[model samples]
Target: MADRVVAHQGAACWATLFTHAHYLPCLAVLLQSMRACQTRYPLVVMVTETVDARTRERLARMGCVLRDVDAWRVPHADGSLAFERFQNVWTKLRAFELYEYERVVMIDSDMLMCHNMDELFDLPLERGMIAAAFACTCNPKQIPTYPAEWTPRNCGYALRPHPPNDARQLTKPTYRLINSGVVVLEPSQEQQAEIHTFILRHTERVAQYRFPDQDLLADVYRDRIQMLPWYYNALKTLRQCHPDLWNDGEARIIHYILDKPWLLGPSPCGEHTHLHSLWWDAYASLAAHPATLSMTRDEWANEIALHVRGI
Candidate 1:
C-alpha cells in the first residue's frame, strides 16, 4: 500500500485492513477486543487512499499504527469480485509487503475476538510457511448465489475434530483450501514481489477466483501453508452447519465470514442471538468514542433487529 512497507524485521505484531469509512465500527470493535485481551503486539491498521482524514485521526487517537495503501489496480471486469462487498480487498496483499515485522498476523476486520491469541506469534513459522485455518466452504444458509461446490463434505474441516495444537497441523498437512481471513506470515519483499507477478500474469484466472485474494494465496502457497486450530478463525456458520466441530468455549476468534452482525443483514446460519449480542456489546462500548455510528443506540438496534431473520 505504501510505496514501501519498511517495518523493522524483528518485531511481531497483529494487523487488519479497512478500505472505507463504513467499516470503521467493525475495526473499532476489533481494536477494542485486542485491548480487552491485553495483547502485547501492536495493531497496524492498513488504509486505502479513500479513507477520510477524520476517521484516520480517530484511529490514530485510538493508538493504531496507520499505513496508507494503494489498491493493487486489479483489472476487475463485471462481477469479478468474489462478493460484491469485497471491494479493494486486493489491497490486503499489502500485508505481505510489511517486510519489517518478523511475522505478522493479518486478521480480517469482519471478525470478533473471543480471547487473547498472542501465542500465535510464538508458533513455528519457517521461512516460506504461511499459517491459517482451512476455509469452511460449506454455504450453510444455502445462499443460491454461492457456487454448488460449497458443500459440507467439500469443507476441509467438516469431520476433523478440533486440533489440540499446531503439531497436528504445522507438521503434517491435510487439506489444501486456506481461508485468507486470518494469516500468520513472515513477510518478505521477495514473496511480495512474487505475489505481484502472479497476479499480473494470471489476471484472467485470478479474477475468476471464488474468494479473490484467498484463492490466489492458496494457489501460490499450497505446499507451504499450515493450519491452526479452527477455533483461531472460527467461522460463525460452523455452529449451525458443522455442529460437531463447533465449540464456543474453545474458540479464539469468531470469523463472521458470511455476513457481519453490524450490517444486520439476513442472519448467517440462522439466528445466533448470543453471537449478535457479543458484537453489539463490543460496539456499545464504543458509544462514547468519537465518530462511530450515526443513530441513537435504541433506534438503530430496533431497526437492525427487525431485519435479522432466521433461516
Candidate 2:
C-alpha cells in the first residue's frame, strides 16, 4: 500500500467539505481516523466563508490544508421550498474546482474510515471519468420526498456478479446512479464549468435532483463512471435495508447516511449502535492525542451534552 501511494505522491489528495462551525466536530473525528490510518496523502478541507476564523484556526491545528471557497447554493433552480434544505449540499461539487490535485478522493465529513484506504489513490482515474460506489436505492425510509425511481430493484447493487464476486467492478448499470458519498474524482476546470452550467441551465432537470449533489453528479457523469464495490461507500442503512449486499467486516469506510453517530451519543440506540461507538472511539482517541488542539475536553463534553445529545 505504501509503494502504491508513493506512485501518486504530489499528484493526489483526500478532500472533504466543512460548510460551517457546527460541522467542525464531525470533521475532527474524521481527521482523527485518518491519523489512525497513517494516511500519507494530504487532506484538503474545503471550508465555506460561513466558518469563522476560530474554526479555521482549529482546522489548521488539526493538520488540514484549508481551502476557503465560496458557498454554492442555487435554490431557485430547484424551484421547490421542500427541497431548499438540501440546496447547501450542492457546495460539495466545489471539490471538482480543485484542479491542482490530479486525483481527489472526496468524501463527506460525516463518514468514518474503518482502515487504511490509500489503495484508492492508486486506482486508475481517467479524465472525465470517476470511480464511485453504486447507490443502494432501497428507499428504506419509504418517504415520499425521495424520487419515484429510488427502489431496490432499480438499485445498481441489485445487478449480480455471477458467483457473488465482490472483486468485480461494474461500469454500466441501467440505473447508472453513483453514490457521491465517496468518489474518486479527476479534477478539471472544464468539467467543473460544464457541471455548473448543466445544473443552472436545466432548471426543470435540476428539480428532480432530490439528493442535491448526489443526483446532479450521477446525472452529469452517468455514462462516464466506474462503479466500485459497495464496501467503499458502505451506507449504514444497508445493514438492515440491503443486508444481502452488506458485510460490515469488509466495509473500508462507513457512510453515516441517515443519522450521524456523534449526535446519537450513548443513548438507547438501536439501528447503528456499534457503528456509533466506532465513531465515538475515534473521538475519544482524538481527545487524548498530545497534539490535539481543536476541542478541549470540557468543550467536547458540553457540545455532546447540550448541542448533540440534548441532555
Q: What is the C-alpha lDDT of each candidate?
A: 0.73, 0.74
Residue pairs with clashing backbones, model 2: none
Location of the lowest summed lDDT over 10 successive residues in candidate 1? 302-311
Q: How many backbone clashes does candidate 2 have?
A: 0
Indicate the TM-score of model 1. Answer: 0.83
How would you encode candidate 2's per-residue C-alpha lDDT over 187-268 as one tens digit per residue?
8888998898897788777865667787787888866676788888888887887678788788888888876776766553
lDDT measured at residue 176 in model 2 versus the true structure, 0 to 100? 71
Residue 178, candidate 1: Cα error in Å is 1.7
Model number with the top lDDT: 2
Cα deviation at 128, candidate 2, in Å, is 1.0
lDDT of 1 by residue, 176-294 (tens): 67788899887888889888888889878876765677777888887767677788998877787777777889888888776678776333234676677777777656654433434
Q: Which pairs of residues have clashing backbones in candidate 1?
A: 7-100, 8-100
* Top candidate, metric TM-score: 2
